[model samples]
Target: MTTLHQEHTAHDHEHGPACGHTPVPHGDHVDYAHDGHLHRAHAGHYDECEQGGHVAHDGHGHAHGRDCGHDSVPHGDHVDYLHDGHRHAAHDGHWDDH
Candidate 1:
């Protein structure tokens, strides 16, 4: 199982609709994609929202990249391609849902 990151970010502002960062529903929580990373609200602060693991989509067939007709999302150190209703990030030998 993956553990949720409880580390807070250095942002001095709150994130919401007026914060300019898009809010995305991630499982049971909401994550805001800002500054090239995902942020989640915690106890009076914010968390980095890191899901540090790999979950490969074994039946995915399309190769996503430049001009793949999907929205691009900037993750921590790489890019994720939006497919269907979720984000896909390229991993070791397959695509991992971001």
Candidate 2:
């Protein structure tokens, strides 16, 4: 005698503003939050990923580290810094299993 088993998996294809390939949910020129994320703010401005979303200005800074005073995006294990018209990425010498 023999037995058989089957398995199945599901995947989600949702995309966000960062994807840069999809249109904004409202289908108009929405305000990109000062932090880099887009959310509902003005009729043509989107809100932030959190709250009080503002237009994504050229020098507002990172979305995650906006309150931290850093002008770059943090990519998990490392931090990216942008200043003086230059950009750099550095690791804090720490790693996690996650």
Candidate 3:
């Protein structure tokens, strides 16, 4: 009779943030957080929609349409930015993985 033996091993790994973005000051602006993202709006800048409604600002002196591609990730009670594929989490903030 012949018999065979098998061996198994377990490994552990660590993961950091997912994206590569840093939060830069967009000037004196207000932010609207929604769906794990932040939508910012700055003064003096306006985003006029086809329906004649203001949307968002671009930090510069210009306005953007409804799709003003300035979305940031939402950390635990904090805001995070993703740039160059790097994730920049907010400092002195807690990370909620829920």
Candidate 4:
């Protein structure tokens, strides 16, 4: 997928451990999950987080889909499940943590 350069404009609040937003450990930097979207701090602004590659979710047992009881978030193309403070998406044959 060609991820766009998206920035969350007009956002005044800062994101960190004390910001009350859930901090997710993305590749190198951290992304804060607010509402249902992931935001990453950029140059004086925040951008919608889009991970470069898939990070396998090892040992995942739960299957996320319709009627899975978890909140389904509309990601780029597929759906991501809001699971335990993070997001999960079905990959090749496993799951990926977003």
Give lDDT per model, in order: 0.79, 0.32, 0.30, 0.78
- Candidate 1: give its CA RMSD in angstroms: 2.2
Candidate no. 1 TM-score: 0.77
- Give me the overall lDDT of model 4: 0.78
Candidate 2 lDDT, 9-94, residue by residue in tens: 22122234674432323323332223233233333323332222222234433343446453544433454444333323432332
Local accuracy of candidate 1 as per-residue lDDT tens digits, 11-84: 78798878887676777777788888878887878888766677787799999989999877788789877676
The order by descending TM-score is 1, 4, 3, 2
Residues 1-98 of candidate 4 have per-residue lDDT tens digits of: 22346998888889988998767665567777676677889888999887666678899999988999987766666778877766789989898987
Q: What TM-score goes with each of the models?
A: 0.77, 0.21, 0.23, 0.58
- As for TM-score, the candidate ahead, 3 or 4, is 4
Candidate 4 has a TM-score of: 0.58
Runs with alpha carbons beyond 4 Å of true place in candidate 4: 1-44
RMSD score of candidate 4 (Å)? 5.0
* Candidate that beats the other on lDDT, 1 or 2, i.e. the better one: 1
**CA-RMSD of model 3:** 22.3
Q: Where does candidate 2 stray beyond 4 Å?
A: 1-69, 91-98
- Supply candidate 2's per-residue lDDT for 21: 31
